[model samples]
Target: IALTDIGVGHDTLMAEVVPGIDFIIGGFDGRGIREAYEHPVTHTVMVRTYGGVSDLGRLLIHYDRDAGVITGYDWSRISLLAEQETPDPLIKEYVEKNIRSFLKRGVDNSGFEN
Candidate 1:
């Protein structure tokens, strides 16, 4: 497994160069992978999550302990919907406080309006 910020091409290159790399997770410049991809040559699974805090990527690997290798995998991207999900009180409070501070500073709060 590897965590990288060098983007997809490099991530794939790393997998090609290195042996026994079953997975690579990467993101760059707020860009994200809409779907997971596997390299044809190396058969390494690569996935990335959205850059901000709104979405999460999940990868579940099926491993063979006897063989010491990955057998298969499952991947998904989960969206955090505010209307469907309950917010943590502490985080909500902190965000609200920051919004108030930005407003006080005339920081153009229009962009943050939901």
Candidate 2:
């Protein structure tokens, strides 16, 4: 969900692109459970938040606000950055670094640029 306009909006976006395998598609699909929602006949999806930049132009990141930190990230950038020979690794690194710094209460994740 694009929770922009908050105190740390960009931080919310950055955590998404952080390198991790925590977001495999089927990961969110509850397994071994015979829930009708999982049936192929269903077109509707069960999710909370949605909409932001991605391959499909706008992507959704399902987040559970009650517990905290991001649980997954869909690498939808690949579709959008198709012509890029080398994606902006710097931005991702900058995000991770800022996250670390912020965790240490020594720095913030904003003011970064190409």
Candidate 3:
């Protein structure tokens, strides 16, 4: 199966419905999540978009603590790759934008929305 290729267990991935970005987390062998958090190799995670790829569209992000590189999924399209660069702009911009948007709406301080 496609998941086996990526080592993502089908029965595990926990389905979470984020108001802005829908994604799946826990319920896996930990390898998938560990790898994602580790940034060993680039991986794609699916998200539900109202007018993007489809009901569920795959979004890629690269996370590496060593290089401080937080990369978006389309690394191939980048001139400088995450594996080669120290800090990727894609990751930085994503984080900044998301934070700005969240603060604008004044996200609730009472609960862990995530």
Q: What value does the lDDT take at residue 97 in candidate 1?
A: 76
Clash totals in order: 0, 0, 3
Query: Model 3 off-target regions past 4 Å?
Result: 1-85, 108-114
Better of 1 and 3 by TM-score: 1
Computed on alpha carbons, the lDDT of every model, listed in order, comes to 0.83, 0.35, 0.37
In angstroms, the error of model 2 at 61 is 33
Residue-by-residue lDDT tens digits, candidate 2, 11-100: 323334433323212211122111212112322221212223323322355667998755543333233443645557898788777676
**Top of the candidates by lDDT:** 1
What is the C-alpha lDDT profile of model 1 across 1-114, one tens digit per residue? 998889767887897898888899887756678788888898888898877766898999999999987789999988775876788999999998787777766766466533
Off by over 4 Å in 2: 1-87, 106-114
Query: lDDT, candidate 3, residue 52?
Result: 21
- Any residue pairs clashing in model 3, and if so which? 12-27, 60-73, 70-91
lDDT of each residue in 47-99, candidate 3, tens digit only = 22222211222346556779876545421112223454577688888978798
What is residue 69's positional error in candidate 3, in angstroms? 39
